[model samples]
Target: MGIYGFDLLIAGLCLLFKQITQLSYVFSFILLFLSGSVIPFENLPEIVRKIGLMLPLTQGVLLGKKIVFEDLSMSAATGSSDFLWLVISSLVYLTLGVLGYKKCEKIAKEKGILSHY
Candidate 1:
């Protein structure tokens, strides 16, 4: 759900800022690295790890680890602050994505570029 929100946000941004499509690869690369897909979270530098902890993907990854490797039940694994963060972040991102897309859609319609975009 959080990842879907993030993708929706990016899609809306691309409609408003076409140039972003070109830079999205770089953005994805950075996101993957920060989310600990490329390296273990603990091995990351202190500052990077701190920043990563705030990202939605990081929360998902950590939660998944706890449920899988740690054999924790879903309720037990998600009972902590991490789950709260994930829910909050997901809602925030999803709301922002919908609002932004609506705004951009209006602008695109006004400019007569909605179809092309």
Candidate 2:
């Protein structure tokens, strides 16, 4: 689940930076793997842990692990409330990525960088 959201973010970024090297997919894969195995947020310091929690991958991994390890029922694992939160987080990321990309494009256009396109 976390990987899914992370993939979405990376895909979005790739779309927004199509002219640049397409590394988001690989980067997201590495990040997702790290999120799951290397530095589980539980092992992080307080502030770093909080920052980790804000990441979509973290939320997805936590929810997924709870379901897989604890035998939590789907209803329990993806309760309406919890699902809504996931949706909200995804939407927020999507919105921010799109707006930021648009702003960058606008700046590039104003600076004539976009003329080459």
Candidate 3:
């Protein structure tokens, strides 16, 4: 799941940037907020909470919280609907990341600038 998110992050950066410097700060903040790491998910505004729920990392964060605070067994936690959602989101990110990377490669090849950015 983490690998899927990391792949998506890398592919997104490749698609969006000609140079990657200074982009980490923005990505970090967005990831932190959307993943519910910076604040409790219940504390977020309604709309923001809804948005965060749709993101890939939110379920993982929630599962971790449950495991720690509620002492949920790994098997029990993974059997929940949240785990299903996490799997679905992982597949979505994996697909998007592969497509984005392919697109970026095509563009770079066409531009004849295949050297490292």
Candidate 4:
């Protein structure tokens, strides 16, 4: 799940780069590590932990680990409200990423930064 989310973020950032500067491979790597690390959220300072929990990648990694390691049945995995929230978060990330890319593209066009392709 971490890998999947990392790939998605990379794809999104790449798509967004034409419109935004300071977004590069290093930033993507940092975000990916933040999402995949297993340090307990509660062990972190409160504000940082809250920010971590709000990240979609974190949610994906947690829920993905549960689904992969547990003996939960399909219904138990998908029917639970918590899992539903994870699904929603994943969708939200995907949708927002795409929309952000589009918005950035528009801004780049206005700023005459778009590359001919």
lDDT of 3 by residue, 2-35 (tens): 4465556575566546576467566778878977
* Residue pairs of candidate 3 with colliding backbone atoms: none
* Candidate 3 or 2, higher lDDT: 3
Q: Model 2, range 1-117, lDDT digits (tens) per residue?
A: 434544454544444455544486467555555455466657767876666666666666777777888888888767756566666776776676666656666666676665453
Model 4 clash pairs? none
TM-score of model 4 vs. true structure: 0.63
Best lDDT among the predictions, by candidate number = 1
State each model's CA lDDT, in order: 0.80, 0.62, 0.76, 0.61
Q: List the residue pairs that clash in candidate 1.
A: none
**Segments in model 4 whose C-alpha atoms lie over 4 Å from true places:** 1-22, 36-42
Residues 1-117, candidate 1, lDDT per residue (tens digit)? 666766777776777676686677877888889989899988999999988887788888888888888888988767888789889887776777787777877776787776673
Model 1: residues >4 Å from true position, as ranges?
A: 17-20
Clashes of each: 0, 0, 0, 0
Please estimate how well model 3 matches the true structure, expressed as its whole-model Cα lDDT: 0.76
- Which of candidates 1 and 3 reaches a greater lDDT? 1
Q: What TM-score, computed on C-alpha atoms, does each candidate reach? A: 0.83, 0.65, 0.85, 0.63
lDDT of 4 at 20: 28
- Model 2: what TM-score? 0.65
What's the lDDT of the predicted structure labeled candidate 4?
0.61
